[model samples]
Target: MMRIGLILAGGQARRMGGIDKASAILNGRPLIHHVLERLAPQVDQVLISGRSDYGSGLTVLADRTDGPTGPAAGLHAAAKHLADVPDCGLITVPVDAPFLPLDLVERLCAGPLPAIAHAGGRMQPAFSAWTPVEVAAQLAHRPAGAGLALIQLARDANARTVAFENPGAFRNINSAEDLAAAEADVD
Candidate 1:
């Protein structure tokens, strides 16, 4: 099945002083570049889900709601935007996670159901595969403040977790300290 990569770039980033994490520099390249690189080869196309003000080369799907309410809204928006596409799944990732595994798409698509990365015994919901129609239907009935909970959605959808030995594959850069740690790991 064809897969579309969705980069969730709508977070408030309060910890990063309201800066756009996707545009942050890591190892001399914008973090989003790393995400796109990993996602590009794995999917037919890529879309960045965020506010319209944040112009990016990739297709942008603006969240119709406000705040970091949750990733669910962005996921919902992406699903709705790509509703026309048939037989495609969405591989969603956070823009701040520059170290996402190269095999992320493959591993996610290997399952019969929606799948996520379970690295270091933690379920990384942001890095999972989703079907737009299925996800959008779930979003329509999801309770308020429930949109950000990917784990719950996955469980409800009977999604499976793809365990990986490499914890670095899911490492995310949320603060300057996290960025430092990621940089050190890269070295």
Candidate 2:
């Protein structure tokens, strides 16, 4: 089965003064660069769910206008791309998570068809592996007023929660202070 990586980078970064989080600098490189460096080797192809490529050379999928907004829209766009594809699965991660685990895909794939990382006693919905066929089916059958929340989708899919030991590995850079702290941790 082919494993594809999808980096969710379309967020407005409202907490970071409305800047593009993907382009934000971290340890001398753009945040997306760090995410790509970690995720590239784990998948066959990588796609960015954002407005711009951010110079990553991978295909950038824009969120669907008709779907519920936020990260779910990005996932919706990805699901559309994977609709006709065969034997392929999507592993998603937030662009701001520069410290993503190196074995994320392998670990997530170890669980059910649709599994999400569970760390810090919470479901990290952005860090998940999804079966495209299942995702498409779920999206199609979504009821009216269900809203475009990924966590809700995960619950409806009965997504397995793969517990991860290192919660810090899932740190998200949502603010300048968070970015500074992450920078301090980078070697």
Candidate 3:
């Protein structure tokens, strides 16, 4: 089964002073580059969901009215874009999560069809895999709770929780300190 990788870079980033999280540098490279490198290999194709232009050489799906703001919107955009292709499994990862595990796709895909990544006892909804019918039936609805709702949807559907040992790999680089910490790991 081919997975369509959707980079969830559409967050407002109010915590990061509204700066584009994807462009934030980690290990001397834009976070998106790191995420893309790890993700592109696992999935058949990649789509970046955000308004900011990163020139990442991947399709950037612009935000639309179909979904609410933030991470939910990104998922909605990907689902809508792939609506024509039936049975497409959508794999989503947040742009701020630069240190995503190498086996993220495999682990998520290995689980139930619409599984989500779980680490540090947290349901990382952005790091998830969903089928087209699943998306249309579940995620296509309006976003009332944003990312959290997606996780709940996965849980409601009984999607497997694929856990990773390294919780740090899911660290969110939303600030200078976070970026510095990630940099230290690389250095």
How much lDDT does each candidate structure score?
A: 0.80, 0.89, 0.79
Error of 3 at 163 (Å): 1.8
Worst 10 residues of 3 by lDDT: 139-148
**Highest lDDT, which number?**
2
lDDT of 2 by residue, 67-130 (tens): 5677877888898888888988899999999999999999988757799899999989999989
After superposition on all C-alphas, the RMSD of every candidate to the true structure, in Å, is 2.4, 1.5, 2.2
- Per-residue lDDT, model 1, residue 26, is 79
lDDT of 3 at 45: 94
lDDT value, residue 69 of candidate 3? 59
What does candidate 1's lDDT look like per residue over 6-104, in tens digits? Answer: 998888888877777887777887778877777888889888887642445677887755322578778887878888988888999999988788888
Measured on C-alpha atoms, candidate 3 has an lDDT of 0.79
Clashes per model (N, Cα, C within 3 A) = 0, 0, 0
Instruction: Report the alpha-carbon TM-score of model 1 versus the true structure.
Output: 0.90
lDDT of 3 by residue, 1-187 (tens): 7789998887777778877888887877888988888898999999988876488778888766656556666777777888888657789888888778988988888856888888898888778898767766775554644443666677777887888899888888888778877787752
Report how far off residue 133 is in candidate 1 (Å): 1.8
